[model samples]
Target chain A: MIKYRQELSFKEALTVILYTLLFNTVIAIVLTYFLKPFWENFVFSQCIGILICLCMLMIFRFITTENPLLWLLTILSGLLVGSAGGFILGAFLTEKNPLVYIRQYHEFIRIMSLGLIFGTIITYFFLSRVRISQAEDRIQEEKIKRLTSEKKTVESHLKFLQAQIEPHFLFNTLSNILGLLDTDLTKAKLMLTDFTHYLRLSLAKTRESTTTLSQEIDMIKAYIEIFKARMGERLKYKFEIQDHIGELPFPPMIIQPLVENAIKHGIEPKVEGGEIIISAKKDQDFLRICITDTGLGFIEQNNNGIGLTNIRERLNSLYDDKANFEVMENVPCGTTVKIEVPIVTD
Target chain B: MSQIKAIIADDEKELRTYLKAQLADVWNDLIICGEAKNGPEALNLVDTYQPDIAFLDIRMPGFSGMEVAEKVADRCRIVFVTAHDQYAIKAFENEAVDYILKPVTRDRLKITVTRLKEQIEVSSVPPSDLPAIIERLMAELKANQKTDYLQWIRVSSRDGIRLIPTDEISYFKASDKYTLVVTGDGESLIKKPIKELYRELNPDVFWQIHRGTLVNVNFIDKVSRSLSGRLVLKLKSPPETLTVSRTYKHLFKQM
Candidate 1:
């Protein structure tokens, strides 16, 4: 919907009445001067003409906004009613009966045709003006809708970037590396390398819309490596994927958030910390990726968290109804998140 | 001076070891009695050892450091160790609670050690204000995190769709596919299941007393033992008694 004002307000009606009276009076004055008709008769006939048209408009409530054909029909009917009424009223004032003029068929046809031509011209002018305004209104609404959606996309992108480069994660990872430097030098170096990789991938991937499954998995591996180093034996992870599926095109930063969520909300909160399993498979025309964690059982509220909601929104915009994001309780304990997107074979 | 006993609690082993090493360097006289890997373990260590100081990581498994501190505040001094929690840090600063940020440096540890030593020497009793401060901080933290709970529930009434505030609800009972939202006035059926409603409602306000029932704590008048030796709850507004299941009987243990 393109909605227009369906009812004319009191102020608008009054304005229309005033404009009609002024226009009719001007015509009446011109006719009285040049056409040699009685001034009072001409003015009275003109007044009757406008009054009948207004009455017809009020009775029918016939201003159409959507259908042009219906609008034309309404104008034609209004002109027919107004001119007929005006001619009858004018004839009664001047002569005894209007049927006397109807007996002269050519004269009656000439007067009625003239009235019809003037009415059609006036109605067409107003209709075109209304149509132009309606078109302008529609364009304005569309521009606003596009601008707002564009702003939303930009805002969500910024939020996604902020979530990816979370200060808490960065600082905690750095703290772990610092602690590791003293006890295990080699492990510390490995963690630093992984941290660098994670950061580089996060920064680079966020700027782009898409990346290969292998590239995203590489980032996820780096991310999990940092967490593994931080949590030690408390954290375990496994990845199950075939070599060919890695080459598939996937949305960047999609899988990593789910992995991060599994670690943060599911695994990190559990005392035993538990394992996270990341797997991907092709189910006919769709590519399904699943992240399962063996930690605390699914909490109903975790699904509404910023990370998961963002993933859902991104998937919705990217694929509309073609992609799906699902969260379910893992068997025995923990939470499993699955994302499915249609595969383009080429 | 008597040897000051202290316990360190952090989920990560390396951080715990690193803090121990740093503590050994900064305050040699302080005795490290125990180390804990999680919140419950930390609380257990606190109870077991009755340590003078507790170095707790703000984020730990089972319970957060803040929750642990709330329980043992009167028993021990808490020094929260966190990575980067802006809200917790702000609360700590406002309350004058001691906290050490992560990548625990010897220099920061030294400052904390000096303050802790002064506090220890000044009073043998744990600070009376510590518990209150921790309680306030926990409340603030909870308020910040719990913005998504359902405030209003949409239900179809006799006339039309009505938005009933969740606060007015006395309880919810599952009935087939729909859940009944009972209030003082009457009950309305909603399409949402009891399981889904439980998730949306604030856990603090709505207690799941049975598999099919979730009762608002505000409306609960009393808990009494039925003749069958099962726990039952009496509501103030609806004037109804609800039976508590064996699985959820522990919820009324405190009462």
Candidate 2:
């Protein structure tokens, strides 16, 4: 069934006409099959069926999207119009006067009732099938959308796992530690202790989803220590945190990956290996953390790696629109990533 | 008392220290004369020290432990130390060569030490099954290291079945039924469709510039606007320019 709009398109109007003809033809065939012997004007009765179907269609077209009473009135008016159409055809076929036709008004009433019943039933059944098919198509589309999103989630999770284990960083740090063992024993010892702590924290169950801000900071500190050992004198970094912000809840591995990105993309590419400044500040209901590196800022085109993208995706999933992550240029030089997360107290 | 010399080679110092401490507790005569952090260094140590036994971590920087084991198999008896579990160690189960899992406890070290002592007492050379065990382990590691990235493409050309590196390809164009794999060497034809090939290539390198065109970003010389305001990609080689449709023009926006 076609729903009413401001105006029906050519295709929609054609569909309406086609359905009307089909339903009316079926009703006429059924009527003729039963009353063919008694009715002499069988062909005339078929023409009357087509005329009455046209009346029903016109009534529907004019009052489909109007008030409920108007629609009820339209149905009642359609029956009257259909009966009148049948009477005129009967009068015309039998070559009788209007007064003579009035005697057989009961026959006209029966034909009108049959037309109304069959027309409503066929229209309702056809509309129900169309609506059901439309509903099933919508359901299938929703299922496909859900499966595609699920696949993307699983793929991102796998990428997150891979990012957690930086084999290049690991091997380089191990080699740096070996190099340090020959010259500086104390520094090597310090690096090894931090490396083991970092490994332990990374493997801990807390890192699977959530961790306290202080725990994430501790992991970042350990990471910085390992990086400092590897880069040595070429890289420098500092951290500033507001008082009492340590115990706030934060996602694990989020801040650490950003800091890693800063070093890998920002500092390591530069010859001098610039300094990084990480700061955390509290503002009303939001906690803002900024990681700024003094390296080749926006000049590096290949800066969007899995780590930064994963951070953004995880943030979106966790906080929806409440959290924000932005990458902007630092004043003097380099890039600054500012993350603002809602402070949740427990 | 006879002194048994041994070499400990692991990328991590902590593991090496723990293994040495466990060995000292298990066998007093087994002295670790040298330590190497990587495979090449381990090979150098085996040559210089000529140790009776060598403990090699399977995953090491540079050459890796399996490669080192091959070079030192003639002179030293080998024990592979790996982070992989017993399932991965199934290749070593039936062979004469032994393997110990990581986070090695004192008991596991003692077992390996006792086996080494027994072997040394029996013969100077390695057991006959050592070569076969190493070969199997190498094959297993190689199989595990195979990644999902599209590394090479097999093309049936007039030159008779050439395997071309995907990295050498500058771009791909779909023509009729076959896709043309254009490389610096020459253009090759592959039966695989462009859509299927696109999924296998690294997204960072190969970008879909058009509906039927995929170009490697490294080969891109410049992106310029045409008189008709359409974006055209000027490639470095073959002197061919590809038109970017309005739908895919965002790919060149950052350039």
Candidate number achieving the greatest lDDT relative to the actual structure: 1
Candidate 2 regions exceeding 4 Å error are A1-25, A30-215, A222-250, A253-313, A319-346, B1-4, B83-87, B94-96, B145-255
TM-score for candidate 1 (chain B): 0.62
Candidate 1: lDDT of A216? 94
Q: Show pairs that collide, candidate 1.
A: none
Error of 1 at A64 (Å): 11
**How does model 1 fare in lDDT?**
0.80
DockQ of 2: 0.02
Fraction of native contacts (fnat) of each candidate: 0.46, 0.00
Give me the runs in candidate 1 sitting further than 4 Å from their true place.
A1-115, A149-157, A272-275, A283-285, A292-299, A302-304, A307-338, A344-346, B146-148, B151-190, B193-255
TM-score for the A-chain in each candidate structure: 0.69, 0.67
Minimum summed lDDT over a 10-residue window in model 1 chain A is located at A1-10
Model 1 has a DockQ score of 0.20
Q: What is candidate 2's lDDT per residue for A274-298, written digit by digit as tens?
A: 8998899899999999898887664
TM-score of each model, paired residue for residue:
0.70, 0.48
